[model samples]
Target: MKILLMLRDEFYQANPGLIEDAKKLGDVRILYTDQGIAKDELIKEVKDVDVILVAVVKIDQEVIDAAPKLKYILKHGAGYDNIDVEYAASKGIPVTNAPGVNAQSAADHAFGLMLAAARNIPQKDKEIKSGHWELSMGTEVYKKTLGIIGFGAIAKAVAKRATGFDMETLVYTNHRDLAEAEKLNVTFVDKEEIFKSSDYLVIATSLTAENRYLVNQETLSLMKPTAYIVNVSRGQLINEMDLMGALEEKWIKGAALDVFEVEPPINHLPGMREVVATPHIGGATFESIKRIGDLSIANIVKLMNGEELEHVVNGVHSRVTQR
Candidate 1:
């Protein structure tokens, strides 16, 4: 069995031991690349692979067709939107992702970004480093209204944290669990109310075709000028151009981003002190990676050994064994 793992250089650096463990399962080929890797290069490398473990590089029908020996395609993290799981299923290739393993890690980072944006933490630190001493007025998070876009694991984890700050959590999601909302002390509200009432708004909903660019000029217009928006979810959810205009016009207080639509963003909007950006490191903690690594490798081993597959996103697991 041949297992091909593709992620950035830093991820490999953090999990040298995990790579070694994967070698114990089969012939492991690791690629150091980001999400925007060329399709030709990916096709060339995947020609004879039995398994493909990818982080960001998309696995469309072309790449799937190129891998004649392909049996399994595993996402190193959540958000299998990068892969065409339905197409892979049609081809009898099983696709799975390590989902919800980094909920706490991502939730922690979301809260951190919220506080950083609200308090202008990065801006103040920069000023102090440049030999300036002055106080900047920051928003008080204590007892503020926190609005979340989804009710998934990460969102739930975030709502749990909000309790400690005595925040009123408002959620907007198509999949409403009233019992869970009552238990967490979060209210299920509409999108307009979420935008209008939140002191901090977090985008945690899973990215789908329907909800892409969920945050636009109309939504931004509804937000209070003092409210801050933090996205710990996929970047495409927010219209970057619209967000840029809002920031320039002070439509909202500020924005903090963990992901960008075209990462690493071409513009970055470095001149805008109101914008704080991170390289999608919400789930990059060492602890979270270990959980993803263990689950990913274990799934791969199961596939190779003809054992029961876990975390199957595509319904081709049974067909894969037949092939």
Candidate 2:
């Protein structure tokens, strides 16, 4: 048996123990590249491997088809959107991710962005560093309405922290699980209502085809002119062009995003000073990375030993057997 670990150099540098753990299961092969393994690269690297571990790399149908002996795929992070789920299911390969691994860190980053945007912290710091003392008036989070776009673990953490600021919380989820909503004291409302009523609208939803451009012109138009938007979720959820238009037109006061439609290209937007942006570092903390690495390795090890995985994305299949 063999396991191929595909990850960036940073991850490998942080968690050298994963390589030793993989050696216990099989001959371990490491691909320390973040550009993503192309189909041919995946084929060559995983040809004789029994398992594959990946992080932030696209695992499409072609890659799955190339590795005939591959049984399981372990994603280092919570989101498994980069993997082709239906195709992996068809191939009888189970995919698993480290859910809630970075929830706290991501929530903290979300709140940090909100605070920075609300108080103009970034602008003030920049001005001071450039030899000026401009004390601009900023809004307060207390006694304000906070609209959360998703009710997942990260959103729950955010809601918990929001209570400290005495902010009213409202949530919008597709399923609207009332029992869960009650626990957080968060009212379940329609998406439109959340958009219209929120002073600080936080986007924490997972990325899916149906809600890809959910925050386009119509939704932005409904928001208050003084409203601020913060997105720590997938960047594709908001249409970049529409967001740019909204900021330019002052449809909303501003936006603070840790993720963008085109990552690293976030700075390319004209007049981006109207918004605050980070380089998708919502889950980049050292603690979060360690948690994710440990969980991902554990999941893969369990699957290799014919044990149940902690966060299986696909239903149980008998295709993978321990040798």
Candidate 3:
């Protein structure tokens, strides 16, 4: 069996052993580039591979067509938006992601972003280093209304963390469960209500055609001027241009983002103290990467052995998996 592992150079360096571990199962080809692997080269690399493992590179119809022999596609982490699961499903090429592996890590990042944006943590630190000791007024998270966009694993984890801060979490999901809300001590609310009521808003929903740019002009208008927005999920979930306008016009006080519309966004988003940006490190914790790698490799092995797979997103029950 042959496998193609496409990852960022930094991620490969941090978890060097994953390649070696995958080697135990098949003829593994490791590909790395600081920027996502170029599509032309990716096509060449995947043409003959039986399985493909990905980080942030797009696995669209073109890439899928090139990988005629591909039996399975594994997203290195939870978010599979980078992969075209629908097209792969049509081709009988199963796709799976390491779902809960990075839940705690991403949840922690989301909460940290809320605190950093609300309290001007990064801004204050920069100001102090520059010999400006003036105290910047900041908001508190204590007893604040926290609005979350989705109730997935990471969302649930973030909600649980809010308990320690004594936050009131209002959740908005397409499919809501009253019993689940009661158990988690959160309230079910409409999207408009979440926007208008939250002191701090978090974008935790998965990116999709239906909800792309979910946070835009209309929603920003609903938020309080003192409110802050935190996003550790996909960048496309919030419209960057709209968000920048909102920040410039002071529609919302601040924003903290781990992902952006473009990775290493060409223009500095916000370009001010109010926005704290991290280079998509929500799932980069050492522990979380290891967990993601382990689960990913286990699924690859299951596919190779033709066993039942876990976290299969495309529901590909049977396929002519080539070796």
| Stretches of model 1 off by over 4 angstroms after superposition | 318-323
Top-scoring candidate (lDDT): 1
The local distance difference test score of model 2 is 0.84
Residue lDDT tens for model 1, 227-298: 899999999999999999998899899998999888778875534789878888998888888888899888
Candidate 3 Cα errors over 4 Å, as ranges: 318-323
Candidate models: Cα lDDT each: 0.88, 0.84, 0.87
Clashing residue pairs in candidate 3 are none
Model 1, residue 43: displacement in angstroms? 1.3
Estimate TM-scores for all models: 0.96, 0.92, 0.96
TM-score of 3: 0.96
TM-score for candidate 2: 0.92
Q: Please give the range of 10 consecutive residues that has the lowest summed lDDT in model 1.
A: 314-323
Q: How many pairs of residues in model 2 come into backbone collision?
A: 0
